[model samples]
Target chain A: MSREHQKYRAPDALDHTRELLGKLAREVSVSDWHLVIEVRPDDLPEVALRLRDDETLSCKYISCIIGVDYVDWMEALYLLRSQEHAIPVRLRVRLDRERPEIPSVTYIWSGANWHEREAYDFFGIRFIGHPDLRRILTREDYDTHPMKKDAWPHRVRRTEWRWEDIERPKRLPGETDRRDRS
Target chain B: MSTVESKNDAVNPGSPVNQDGPAKPSFHLEEMILNMGPQHPSTHGVLRLVLHLDGELVVSVEPVLGYLHRGFEKLAESRTYLQYMAMISRLDYLSGFFMEWGYVRSIEALMGVRAPKRAEYIRVIIGELNRIMSHHVAIGDFMLNLGAVTPFFWVFRDREDAMDLVEMVTGQRMMYNYLRVGGVRWDLPDEFEAGCRKFIKEFPAKIDEYEELISDNEIFISRTLGMGIIKPYEALDYGISGPNARASGIDWDLRREVGYSVYPEFDFDVPLGQHGDCFDRYKCRIEEMRQSVRIIEQALDSICGGPVNIKLPPMIRPPAGEAYRAVETPRGEFGVYIVSNGGLRPWRLKLRDPTFSAISMIPKLTAGNKIADLVAIVGSLDLLMGGVDR
Candidate 1:
């Protein structure tokens, strides 16, 4: 209820994971929320399997797969949770901006199927080996990933019928096509 | 054309199955593609399911979502931290309080601001009330999906009563943006206790009537029992939480496990089911409502007077860090992950909606079951499209 009230703490099993992942992973640190681990794009599948199968770090459930655009590079954050320990680990993978592709973890966690598709949909970050990797939460014809910082809002994009074309159609009294008005 | 003919010949070596002759097969099997809806009523919202069916049995179900997507994560990046609170309620309209609570709690953790004692108690009270309200809808809708219409009306009647009590304090019927970053926006109204007491007193009888009406019905049991059984391991592997996961025999409730807010002070039972079936899921929700009522009763008895909100500066700028806070909503574990950049706006905000993970398991749950069972499975899961497609 108050700031000083410390009701919950991460179990000792999770504390052991910090040390284990620190030894195996590229970089490991602990945050207020969860243990953060950084791994290369190629090692994601192997690390994901270890997180799911390892005795100490059996994070069978994946909460979310978030893709953040950091201007210089794109980062993918995989929030994994071990139901047995009630501890979560944040797996961060940095992808090159020019080729934002990483091996999909759908095989490890079937729940990651949609989350990967969502990441690909928003940031145009391709997930290699992902079956049916297509745009989700957006139309199939949408050319640009709207969540990118540099991408313009859909309303501002130029379409088949521009505002100037509509204005010109209104000015021409002889125009009878409804498509012109649209 | 040559490659297609060779492949056909390879399947039926000597038989003329593909040839236009009288030597046709005795029986034919075809996978029928059926589109359930982006407009169908049973989906609960704008959700589309592309069902691959073999006669009456479902072969696979591909859920086509995004019909209700509004790009909330993208919107959060452009708005200031406090400015995004108004939109949080819209994520899960049924349990708006939990969504608002999760978002604000994450920000509080990032900024090291703790809500006062009285505010925590108020949150527990309103949060339990909202839980009951949401479960009412879940039960009513589940029954309605099985062709019973009376329970829906009965549940809504009680829900309206609960909503009246919430509106008195929050001043909004549906979208109550009452939770601020530090604490709640307003203090409890003068008649808040009396109203909640009146509802809590009569609510148990209503629940009993609801159970007697449908819980024992032959049709309801037959439809729900032994259907969509999710094993404990499968539930955890798929990241199912709240009632759905508990019904599968997983005793992992964020309220009890994480012990956020004043949930630690209140003593209540986490009703779990033995066998993970549709009936168990239904029973879990029914029992959870009773537990919520118990929690509210205790919270009301122990609540004391104090400031509901903490004083704060005009602009809230949490230091550069990230925080993830999850709360037990009626659906499941609803969480908010905030990445602050020592600025007014969040560098990135991601919503970990429990329904999103629950819905992902649909293809596996619906496979091999009859087409009609799809509705029951989805209904028992208690998904919210607003949370799923967000």
Candidate 2:
């Protein structure tokens, strides 16, 4: 009966002719329960800045920064909420799969530093201006970005425990892998 | 998995997590590095904090995580919708029901069906009890960090009674994988109402006892008051949620804000603190326990008779869409973001643990504080390594 009640509007997100967001929004759409404002990778910083400072759409609180790998392309979703309105906004930025890079919004929200590092650790996406862009969750020496779909080459949903399914580390140079015959 | 690093040389390789601070403490000439936990009890989980200290004062604290990472998110991509339900609770074991509730809420939202009225009320009832149970541990463990062993025992002793009530209904005390997509596993047993009512009735008195026992103590006041003050703006900037954020005067609670489940039907108050400090955090939690008791009593009074679960096909696949559903867990806003590609299994499932955001701010919060106060501050945050490491 009502479109206002149906689709979640993020301040002036849907309308692209207004001001700051209007000049930047590449593709404005709605997803699930959020006003999904798709912006260019380079424009992520500006878009985030306005989203935080704009009185109407003051999206100051960022809940999560999710990075998704679609095999062909990469997407970074920022879940934002405003305390004044409690309206949730999703800033979706598409990245090149070959060299997935996005301007970090860490400057806007300090909390995004750790989240950006986590995305960098998992998806191998680089945040251009991230001061501490090191891996947050995985060991720095670990080569594989485990969250990527291709990370697990031979991922078998093992129904029963198999001795071969378990990966064992090789013994140290001098330490022998002695096992009793029993 | 809790890797409590020793006094020095705790950094894994090349000192990855621990970077040198910008404003280095020049007074000491060299920052004395100290490692608190990957194994310390106060750490709560496998969390290693590499603290750079000048004498007894912490210059900068770097938290090293992933010691307890089990790759639960990757596991969800392979398992079907039903199969993944079993492990969601493991995301935050203290309030496993909330974890399960968050995941199932997204699935149910995607399918466009709410659980029957009775089922919702039952969830509210169980969820509040679980909140009290979790806060018990948070309070007890916080007291333990302050070196008060008696309050820890007191909270634990009462926690067992609350756990017994949950066990009677869910068949498990801690890891209650009892929440299904459309509704709960089963309706409340006949005796549960009487027992739960008794717990809620006595629960308020128990909360009062706890407040009287620990709240006014001089040691606790001195240790917590004006220590680790999280400015409201800073709290919002860091994405802190639940009691921690409320203690900082944010006033954002998903149960009240999102109105998920039957929370809107309840009559309760979300206690907020004026000063966002360690003491306020503890007080907010204690007040929340009382509010939980209020919700439980209301739910018990209004719970109606109906089927707890809805009928669904053996093999179910949600349409290709994305949904995010968060619940006001004891810890914070525990949200489950699910992306279904019209498959039996989800394409991607992100279990957002509130502890991740809380832990990210640890280095900022504990800096300049003495090592003893660092324990007090960290304890007040009520961080669980199981959730953060995930």
True contacts kept of each: 0.64, 0.62
Worst 10 residues of 1 chain A by lDDT: A1-10
Clashing pairs in 2: B2-B38, B2-B46, B3-B38, B4-B37, B4-B38, B4-B39
User: For model 1, what is the alpha-carbon lDDT of residue B354?
Assistant: 92
Best by DockQ: 1
Q: In candidate 2 chain B, what residue range of length 10 has the lowest lDDT sum?
A: B5-14
Q: For residue B303, what is the lDDT in candidate 1?
A: 92
- Write model 1 residue lDDT over B15-117, tens digit each, in one string: 4645665443333355889999888877888789999999999999999989999999988987887789899999999999999999999999999998998
Candidate 1 residue-wise lDDT, A53-94, digit = tens: 888678898888998888899999998887776667889999
* Model 1 CA lDDT for position B121: 92
Native-to-model Cα distance after best TM-score fit, residue B239 in candidate 2, in Å: 0.6
